[model samples]
Target: MEFAADVFPGGPSDPSVLTQYADHVAGSVWTGEERLELKLSSHGKKVHSLGRSVPAIEGLVIGTRLSPLIACSVDTGDQGLLSSFVERWHRETSSFHLPVGDVMITLDDVSSLLHLPMVGDLHVFQPLHMDDAVQMLVDLLMVSAEAARAETGQCRGLYVRLQWVRDIYKRRCHAGHWTAASREYLLHLLGCTLFANKSATNVHVVFLEALRDLRYVVHGISYTT
Candidate 1:
């Protein structure tokens, strides 16, 4: 039962944890009357809570400095199952970008918080493929950015991600981007995209350009509320 055949399993194409998390987030495994499955590692192997098995779900998300391209790939033979999962992924992401009410994920009465690292990196608490690792970190920034500019909100942590990306690009020898977190992130992101398929003396063109543009031309800076 392949999850989504359209995702093109290039085997870690985007270098993001978003791809690695696909299995845990979208699998068919169910909990004992629990709506959201809490992870449990057991017996020298990762196993379901009550011995239930479900196909793995993996997706990788990378910010193109200019746009958001979410890619998901699953190992299965069930196209129907994959399509449904893909649709949900798309919906959640699209809704996050919109300037409106958002339904946060909640478990019973508790909810998830922005797990930022001491040095400001969005921490990855679980193991993931090399590719999925990067995607998850970048997506977290997008989610945080929306929350920050979304009419009265406490989630300004996305700014940290925006800064982290710029640092990564600069250290890599690409031209330094803008200083304003959001605007600068957009500038380089768009710069990265223009050369996604080609590269010069060592810089990944697509990622760099996209990162550049995302810094300044992202969206309607403020959603006039």
Candidate 2:
């Protein structure tokens, strides 16, 4: 199917928006255990897409994976953030490698995409007191996963989403600027999100991979363990 028209007609190219979107998901998201789902109708009704994620899993996914996935951006607060995030996300999904769009998705990507929850773009930013960038990552992941699980998926329209995310992330890592404290905190948060998210996604990926490898259940036909 033809992908939706550019979400940011007057704002920026899909590639630029990809960078800004990832930044928002990484740093600004709230720090909590609440599942999230989002239907982003912003930037002049340009991008019509819906996504979701779980509170707990969001923490796990962002807190774990690394390299060309997603990242935090406290500098321009809109750039380089995606890289920080996907860097971790890619690491988390390393085991599955399912081709989650343009990016060869791994089991983590598939499962996370399968289970992601939904909320709204309004919730992307956390309260002032909340500074756990890692938590934000997890929450965003959960939301993304839920959107992915839907039968009418955004993924169907876009194949380069993952690759796009990774590319944006790389740009951020090389170009983003931040305070020493913010940098340190975010770095720490990145580690936290990486371990947490990767651990969670890996469990799902490994389990499914094992099941597939073992053929425990094929086409709904049960195989003896």
Candidate 3:
């Protein structure tokens, strides 16, 4: 299939916009002094996504205020930020070692391709909120996963999607940005979405690498146990 000729046409090409998009997608908006002082715990607020209720695991909040994912501005030509996010996402989704057909996808490239079309130029100047970013990423992953499946039915697109989300949560934990509560919430969000969205597919080997290698069952199939 021929990819879009101009993946990011009229997209957020400005340094500030690019930085904000990257930060939101990478969950780096919660890192600065203006960051909220979240009082998260293993038990926390419930968040709804993909048609299920999930706690805001590893989320940052203050009192009754909590932001799941936020955006921040990055300096011009900050390829390092883009590179780091790509590396982390690649490592999490098994893209680094495994070849998904002839496609060697980089997060920076994939994101530019996947992210801009849906958002268009509306979000050029303003950074995307947490929900918008996740929604966009989810949409992009689903679309990309379908493309990958078309190219190579050798792998489950759902797995790739789940892994992408899983890796985001793991990166947040690694960055020390997420609290125990936030981690739990994010994991639950991912797990719930996986079960709800892709339950029809038979998943005999769903690995929750960040969740201490545990496993669970849904519809007679195994997942992040």
Candidate topping TM-score: 3
Estimate the lDDT of model 1: 0.28
Candidate 3 lDDT score at position 196: 31
Q: TM per model?
A: 0.16, 0.15, 0.20
lDDT for 210 in candidate 2 is 16
Q: Measured by TM-score, how close is model 1 to the native structure?
A: 0.16
For each of the candidates, the C-alpha root-mean-square deviation to the true structure, in angstroms, is 20.7, 21.8, 20.6
* Model 3: how far residue 191 lies from native, Å: 4.7
Clashes per prediction? 60, 60, 15
Candidate 1 residue-wise lDDT, 114-169, digit = tens: 12111212222233442343343345323243333431122222212323444543
The best-first sequence of candidates by TM-score reads 3, 1, 2
Could you tell me which 10 consecutive residues in candidate 3 have the lowest summed lDDT? 213-222
Of the candidates shown, which would achieve the greatest lDDT relative to the real structure?
3
- Estimate, for each residue in 112-208, the C-alpha lDDT of model 3 and write its tens digit: 5423111122111234443443333334322243443432233333233434344444554455544433433334443433233323222211222
Error (Å) of candidate 1 at residue 200 is 28
User: Per the 3 Å backbone cut-off, how many clashing residue pairs does candidate 3 have?
Assistant: 15
Ranking by lDDT: 3, 1, 2
List model 2 lDDT by residue over 1-225, tens digit each. Answer: 122335433222344323443333322332233434432211111111111112323433333232122322112333344334442332223322123533454445533543322221311112221123223322322223333333113333211133223232333334431121222222222222322232211111111111121112122211111
Each prediction's whole-model lDDT (CA)? 0.28, 0.27, 0.32
